[model samples]
Target: MSETESKKPGYAEIASHFRKLIADGTLAPGDEMPSMRDVCEEFNVAITTANRAFRTLKEEGLTVVRPGRKTLVADQPRVAATASARLKRIARTGKPYAPNERSVDHTAQLRSMADPMLAQLLNVELHDEIVLRTRTFVRDGKRTVFAVSCIHMRAIIDVPELLSPEPFGQFWQEVYTARTGKVVTKSPERRGARLALDHELEALGVDVPAGTPVPVLVLVNTFSDEDGPIEVWEDVYAPGLWQVDTE
Candidate 1:
């Protein structure tokens, strides 16, 4: 065979080279790969030829693309946390709220309270700060909804009476007006999609097979007064219970 014809296969050869690099730990996870030009120069090949090789690697889940950045090695088979398996149950059914706690039901409440865009629409004094409170609702051992609430710290501190858990029943706007002497404003938005994590499935009580995908709902909220933004809260729904409407 001619020297050119005798050379090893093209794309397969390139793929093998990269695979060795990965297997040998030379190209570790999160490591940025050389650019196409660099690979072409190193391999003494055309840019198109180098591109074909890289494409094969990407198709095999060996690398990922980061917009505005270089391609990098991906963590193969991605390791998941044990907590992920319990996130759905805890998020959807847990009682009492803790800071940074994850629960689907409570997250929904936070989502609802923060739905209104508050900061951009409200005008407020410089001394004011925003406060966010979130909780979850469960019925018969199943989580149903998530809720969130927010108000200005300065606006709510006056009524020590309102600080009690029962005060939450009073409308937030009324409480704001009573404290700040100004009306509160709200802006809300809703979105829905599939769950992207294992924890999401656990909280939603959905059975995700080894490879099954889950769906989710998202709510964005903003609270404000006549001056400017107060707080922003987001709630993500568990899988199987929400249908996201899209245009």
Candidate 2:
């Protein structure tokens, strides 16, 4: 049998399929999800595998399970949409943000890689030429995250828009795909915490207590296709603006 034919759908793959459906609005709020038996038959998976997929959705706050009622899509998703999910929304709609959400483009320019951590993450030499795109994300008129996107110089050559100071108003990966035909298939992410640097505090407009070190949540995502890395995005979330959604 071929490799593709030998593979079976796992819980993560099942959950991702449903996530895309919800992200694109195919599964609207209050829509009843298929029963576990239905899922099992559809994917030809065992009951345990199907149940695990549903459990993953529930843990992500994308679905609600009542005591005596069927599982339904949550009216308001507690967890933020994944990057790929947001891209799906942007593809359908013109913008990604909700009515009360917006982003301010701070700067986009070609610069030398200064941070050793970023260089290592991007798999580039120190002081290598890279494109820097910075933005501030706001929700309900409050600054929530300061974001920085580091792109290899190749992207700017392939898709010149990466050097534009003005926002593309869409994910650049889509633009890159359009220009170079290299589709992003995977995006690995990492999370950590660190004390806010002086520039980061200024950019986020955060004030730290005198003589006290203020910590910020850091989320880094690396976008890549089959070939390799496309871009690295680092988001510094303001304190009190980050929350874990367990519901």
Q: Please report the candidate that would top TM-score against the real structure.
A: 2
lDDT of every model, 2 decimals: 0.51, 0.76
Model 1 lDDT on a 0 to 1 scale: 0.51
Q: For each predicted model, how many residue pairs clash, with residues at least 3 apart or on different chains?
A: 38, 0
Provide the lowest-lDDT 10-residue window in model 1.
77-86
| Model 1 ranges off by over 4 Å | 1-130, 139-141, 150-153, 159-167, 192-215, 243-247
lDDT of 2 by residue, 1-247 (tens): 7775468799988988887677556788889999999998888888999999999898877799988999998776544443444555666665676434678857998889998988887878889989999988776567777889998877777788778778886677788888788888556567799988877787877877655688888887887766677688888877755433211
User: Against the correct fold, how does model 1 do in TM-score?
Assistant: 0.36
lDDT winner among the candidates? 2
